[model samples]
Target: MNRSEFLQRYHHLRQIDYEADYPLRKTGRAAGVLIPLIDHPDGLTVLLTERAHHLRHHPGQISFPGGGAEPQDNTLADTALREAEEEVGLLRSEVDVIGALPEYRTISGYAMTPVIGFVKPGPVLTIDRNEVADAFEVPLAFLMDRRNHFAHFIERKQQRYPVYFMPWQNRLIWGATAAILRNLSSHLCDD
Candidate 1:
């Protein structure tokens, strides 16, 4: 969808409580992730990042630019913007804060809030080698479409659990990132 159409539909979209169906262990740590949608001439695209391989947590994982909340952050949105800037050099001025999806609890121990935003096309991204290995964009239409989504089951304690996954080219998008994208797809496409 186009920028205007997305904005119009976003305001009317209903929030989906993903945690209601899939419970996760929360560590009481609040986190924020920026789901940046760029207004490309061809179509809207989502900006994502690959975490640096040396990181202690979730290293080399494909994810949104975000991290644990700090005391100086006034809101989760601020945390998202700040992390995005710190990791990918996406200046706050280049993004227009739009809306948010339902807060998600991660198995890794975080109460993550997904902050949605629209980014100006062609924003220069300076990737920080310390935090992120790469920054890239994927067409929103491909992500939102159900055809690209995949579900895999894992056996734990004799119980099977579904793991959401969306493989974009060679990069594997899974775990909380894929779950959040699934939530976004449901919100945007179901209605």
Candidate 2:
């Protein structure tokens, strides 16, 4: 989808109500932004980040640009934008937030709020080495394609957990981030 088309379609997504059914860890809240970058030759791409391995939570995982909500954040949107700027150096003004998806409950215990946004792909992102190890963009078409989505099982603790995994180029996207992407892809494909 083009920028205009994506904006038109996702703007309505903002109106959908999201339920926060899961409890968060330590009373901390986090907000993340799913920034869709549509390149000139390629159409649409989604910007993703690889977190630094030293982080306390979900270290080295493929994720959107975000983190725990701060007191200065007036709203979830603000928290997402602020974290995006801090993690990937993408300015808040450059993003056009389309909507928010359902609040997902992480196994590590976080009630994550995902804010969807469309951004022009020209920004030169300066990654924070302490938080983000690298940053890259994946074709939205590749992710939205059902053929690329797969299910995997792993035993953690004593129970087996099923995870939806998506691989883009060299990046292995799994865990909560992958689940969110799968949900978004399912919604778009169903429409």
Candidate 3:
């Protein structure tokens, strides 16, 4: 959707479902991710990054720029902005923090807070090779469309858990990132 329509439709302050339909740990370390929505002429696009293949966890996965909370961070929002700047060279000043979704606890022991931000897609991002290998943007319209989402099941310890996947062109946006987008869709999509 366009900027005006988005702003008018999405009431960030309203109550929303904090957690997606997934088994979550009771406790996990606080983490934050910025769901950067860049304002394009036609519609908004979401900024995503492919994790470095060498990373210890979730290698080569598509994700938002964020990480575990540091002591220096004043809030989860701060953590999101800090990680975004560090991972993608997105300046803090460029992002306008709109709102946040409730925390989604991952199986990997993270209480990931999804911070939604509005940005203009002009800055040349410097991808940190250590954390991210590539950065790309997917149109928000494509992502928010429920038709584009697929359900995949993973068997762990004889239990089947549903994972969401949104394949966009050559990239497969799945796992937590896709789940997060699904969560966002619940908020942004009209009933």
Candidate 4:
């Protein structure tokens, strides 16, 4: 979708009192993610990052730029934007925050709030090697397509929990990241 249509459709969902299907999870701390959307020549795309392999939690996983909330952050949006800048050098001024989506509780013990925003793509990103392995964008059209969302699961301690996966280019976008994308799809796209 174009910028205007995207905003219109996205705003339509915001009018209702709604959240994603994820109920409160038992694990993890409070966190927020900046889901950056850029209107590219190809189409609208979402910025995503691959976590540094050395990290103790979710190593090498594809994710949004965010982390556990800190006292310095006045709001979840602040946390999201701060983390985005810290991780990927995404300047706060460049982001036009559209709004936030529902809160999703992660099994790793995080109450994640996704802040959606718009940005301009170029040679503007400076990836922090410590927190991020790489930064990339996947077309929103590809992600919004229901066909691209896959059903998967991991066997943890003999328990099976559903996981979502979206393979874009060579990266496997899955787990919490994919779940957030799925939520956005349900809210902003018909398919």
Candidate 5:
């Protein structure tokens, strides 16, 4: 979909009341922003970050620009905006938040809120060397395509759980990130 179409559809997504329970031993909350950048002709692209391998959680995984909520954040939206700025150097003024999807609970024990935002093309991104290792964008059309999504199973300890996995280029998008993307894809593609 194009920029205007994506934004219009996203703005109309039915708000799902969902919550995720992370497996982290400690209780905490995290907020992430799904920044969708739409470039003309090429179509819409979703910005993703590869976290530094040295990080404690989900190291090197493809994710949105976000992190644990801070005390200074007055609301979840603020938390998402702040984390995005810290990780990707995107300014708050540049993003036009459309709405929020349902909350996702990670097996690692984080109740994450995925904030959806529309960004204009061409913002110089400066990645935080310590937090984000690399920044990239994936075609929104590719992600929204149901044919690209596959059901994968993984064994953690002795229990087996089915999860969604999407592979684009050499990057593997799976786990919680893929789950949220799957949810978004379903909403956008619903006729």
Candidate 6:
């Protein structure tokens, strides 16, 4: 869809009290992730990041640009923007904060808020090697299409937790990142 149409539909979606799927995790630290969309000539593309291989948590996992909310951040939105800037050097000025999805609670003890934004095309990113290994873009249409989504279970101890996986080329987008994408996809492609 075109940028204007997508944004209009997205805004209308946020206004509705659609039931959202949140994980059963009851406790977590507040976190935020920037789900950025760049308007291409034919459609919109969503940006994603790969965590560094040596990190203590979720290393080498595909995820949105984000982290735990620090006290310095005034709100969850600020945390999202700041984390995006720190990890990928995406300036706050370059992002147009349009709207946000409902909270996505993760198995890894993060109460993540997916902050949706539109990014100006062709902004140079200075990726932090310590925090992020790489950054890539996936077609929004591909992600929103349910035919491309798959489900698997992660057996932790005795319990099984569902993981949503959406493959783009060689990259495996799964875990909380994929779940959030799935949620966002449902919100956008409801027509």
Q: List the candidates ranked by TM-score, beginning with the highest.
A: 3, 1, 6, 4, 5, 2
> What digit string (tens of lDDT, one per residue) describes model 2 on residues 1-191?
66665556554543343222334446545655555464545588889999999989778889988877778999778988999899888888888886887778776666677888878768779899999999988888788787998887767666666687898877899878877777676546544
Misplaced by over 4 Å in model 4 are 13-28, 154-160
Candidate 5 vs. true structure, TM-score: 0.86
| Every candidate's lDDT | 0.87, 0.75, 0.89, 0.84, 0.78, 0.86
lDDT of 1 by residue, 13-60 (tens): 466545232455435589999999999978899999999999998899
TM-score, per-candidate, Cα-based: 0.92, 0.83, 0.92, 0.89, 0.86, 0.90
Q: Candidates 3 and 4: which is better by lDDT?
A: 3
Alpha-carbon shift of residue 168 in model 5 (angstroms): 0.9
Candidate 3's residue-wise lDDT over 1-191, tens digit each? 98888877677556666335445546788999999999999899999999999999999999999999999999999999999999999999999998888788887879899999999868679999999999999999999999999997888767787799999999999988999999888778777
Model 3 lDDT, residue 66, Cα = 99
What TM-score does model 6 achieve against the real structure? 0.90
**Winner of 3 and 5 under TM-score:** 3
Model 2 weakest lDDT span, ten residues long: 13-22
RMSD for each of the candidates = 2.0, 3.5, 1.9, 2.8, 2.8, 2.4
Q: Model 6, 12-125: lDDT tens per residue?
A: 724444323445546778998999998778888999999999999889999999989999999888999999999999999999998888888876778889999988778799
Show the colliding residue pairs in model 3.
none
lDDT of 5 at 96: 84
Candidate closest to the true structure, highest TM-score: 3
Which candidate leads the pack in lDDT? 3
Error of 6 at 128 (Å): 0.4
Stretches of candidate 3 exceeding 4 Å from the true structure: 12-26, 157-159
| Model 4 residue pairs with clashes | 27-109, 28-109, 28-110, 29-109, 146-191
